[model samples]
Target: MSTDLEVRFKNIYPGKYFLSFSKEDLNTYLKFRSWLPGEEVIDGIEKAGESNMNCVLRVRTNERSFIIKQARPWVEKYPQIDAPVERNAVETRYLGLMGEDVELKIQTPELIGSDTDNFILVINDLGGEPFSFLYEHNSKLTGEDCKSMMAYISRLHQLKPVNFPENMAMRVLNHEHIFHFPFIEDNGFKLDDIQSGLEGISWIYKRDKVLKQKIESLGKLYLGEGKALIHGDYYPGSWLKTELGFRVIDPEFSHIGHPEFDLGIMIAHLLMTGHSEEIIPAMSRYSSEQAVDNELIAGFAGTEILRRLLGVAQLPLKLNLENKKALLDQASDWILSGMIRHE
Candidate 1:
């Protein structure tokens, strides 16, 4: 390694914003792992994804390559969004736990190293775009694909982990957006600013006491005692389509909560993208005995749909205002009545 690079990296503080792996750091890390020749050098660094809260980069060399992920104290894009830095440790913990399960290990990236103090996690890179890209393009998953995905997640929840530290920080952060904000009249979000006429629709829903009561009840269930270990954000953005199969990533929001939360979020995204075929069968594949309450699942999914529609964090969906309003109406119906629509 060059002397200048060594000096620059050696002095790196843990809380640096947009923390990324430099070529020297990557080379040194590889050499430390004995994966590189003493003189081998990294050729380039490519950004992996648009992570607003963390830095993810793919480092490549003629010999080998890997991904470096580092979490910062605050969101990179929106400085106003402050979060606990320890969430990185929580993610690392989730990865380690998943590593112990053979099925999840195959579906998850291989964890190489994790420095809890520095909030850095290094793991193998699964190369491909998010499954979301395909969904957005109107591509559908085959029956086998849906089964495989459902089976993979079933294996996770079936483990029923009980002795793990709760990732309360991430869960709490997500709870605000998913449950609290959508029902509040002035939750500090300008919905119309995101898309035209969105604020008016959001206003109508927020002012509905009946809808708010239904959603708040669901929110209470979300914050209640643990039911099972769940991938808190199990939407398409977290599922990557690799040559091998679907690879799940980004479990930062993981928590010991209702398993239905994961299933509900997944179904909600599928609904938004117009891929409504596998809803029932996939749910059946994942359900075992009376473990998951169908009504609770519907309620959670309903809140998820409404939150994504009216809340601050928006998905890159290609729906017109009328279509979105229709979805909102459907979501409101489901939330108010606890009925899931297969259409």
Candidate 2:
């Protein structure tokens, strides 16, 4: 062991558990796994490539370039903010489990090293465009792009769950199928916010008790339906736009949840975009192109709704509304109508 190893570790990561490796070492291990080619070139290294909610950096050695991703258990900006560290570990665990199962239309970063404080990943920077950028430009995902994404999602759900080591205990699959229970503990949900959100929804929330009931019922289906490994945050931003096709990244939220959780979140964001008429055609076209059960979509929608309200990461639609009451109301309606089973 190098006498100064701890000193170097402290210089790179302060107050955190971490693993650091040189490109030569990283390459040697890759060859041991028969994953690296012989003639790779080293390039200049650059630092920091963060966006929206992740911390990223690039390391280009003669061998290859890898993107290092770090997940902050607490809110990145707000240190006092706390979220589950298990979320990170869970994502890594799921990726390892899904190794042979993933059909990569979009690329996922290759994992290199993993441990408690943080993990190091060496991934292909496929130059994929961000989903928010696509939305901002009003560029609807072409039927082809939609096709690939849907196919990947379908394949993910199609995989057999029986292969996994039966001990993980994903009890969420039980009949109860709790929604937002873990997050509601320390952080309080404001009643006024609910009232404000309800009001902004233009009484649609109050008028649609049927939708609410549907959401509740679907929650059961969500937990009990076909089980598989999922890319927990299957959003546009997690994908790339290229001549080759969509390359995916950011599986930090990955786990064994409803396939609908992945599907509903994407659809909810799509619904939030464009006006009512535009949204209908988009949803219809997407539904036509993708093979899915409306009942399942409704169930996933319910999960999406609860996730928006209580999940650590908030949706962009809510952020755009600006007016506190109006945003809450719109989000409330979004869950009830867009994501809820009743809708």
Candidate 3:
């Protein structure tokens, strides 16, 4: 069945070239786009990391290595899930904007080139592991890490762009997972499969009409436009830890949105990773040029926590059933009260 599916995926898009893990195929594709000079030979190709959205590869040459990302009609991690291939253009535009800013350019990977027809983006690989290890038991982000992350986001929110991709398709897809799908009692996703008793624990919120109503309202706010250009998915997975400092990547979901959306998502992850103490301090590190609405931030934070617990985008959480229940309850409270209470 998997072999058949692979064959079908390869030929799914007529006239559109799909990237494979083969060095020969990549050499042809890269050279065609002039991304690889004629003299530069392709040494090898390997998976860059665990990318959930696109096919990301590290292309090694005699001199150096670079990363190439190709977006398909469906998600690279979950082929059954549909996503927009144009996200490559969105990310390319974002990187182009970042390249103009001195601070942002230093913190993000350099965009080498792009193949618009194939939805492929070639970027200079910033070698380092993501900050995802913070999800492990006893792992915590240092004060410096928190400050750097906050500072990058703070600067990102301050950028003023004349035109930007609406990214409504990506936003709508995220809206379903973040706000609507998790609350559905019969969404076909089994929470217990992720962890025992998680299904039973999720019912406490799923059955709550008031909580769902609040989530629905927050969903509308998320789908609406805002003044700031915010990174749509500002989580640990998108943050890279390198020798210089923390670098940000994957702005495919980025759009003109409220700054609180970014702040709230970051805070939610910090809380989940047992860094609740860093929440207040991290906010302090954020730029005060734009006033942050704590209530809005709390609402988005709570929503993100609930979705990660009950939605398809499950984390590498080390918490047990009891701990998850406590978090679900706390997330509900934060959503309803519009206040972040760490206890």
Residue 268 miss distance in model 3 (angstroms): 0.6
Candidate 1, 36-136: lDDT as tens digits: 66767789998888766776788787767778887765565664566777778878988998899877898898888877766778888888777777546
**Which candidate ranks first by lDDT, i.e. highest?**
3
Query: What's each prediction's TM-score?
Result: 0.90, 0.61, 0.96
| Higher-scoring candidate on lDDT, 2 or 3 | 3
Question: lDDT per residue, candidate 3, 146-165, as tens digits?
Answer: 87898899899999798899
* Per-residue lDDT of candidate 2, residues 1-343 (tens digit): 2435455445655676432345555455445544456665435445434354334656575665666555544434543444444445655655555454546433454565455355434555555456665545655676676666766666666655554432122334222223433123333444335434532332343345665565566655554534665676676667777667766666665555556667766665555443334334444444222355654665564445444533444444433324433433544555545433212
Deviation in Å, model 2, residue 2 alpha carbon: 27
Output the lDDT of residue 73, model 3.
79
**In order, what lDDT does every prediction score?**
0.78, 0.51, 0.89
Candidate topping TM-score: 3
Candidate with more favorable, higher TM-score: 1 or 2 = 1
- Candidate 1 local distance difference test against the native: 0.78
For residue 246, give model 3's deviation from the true position in Å.
0.4
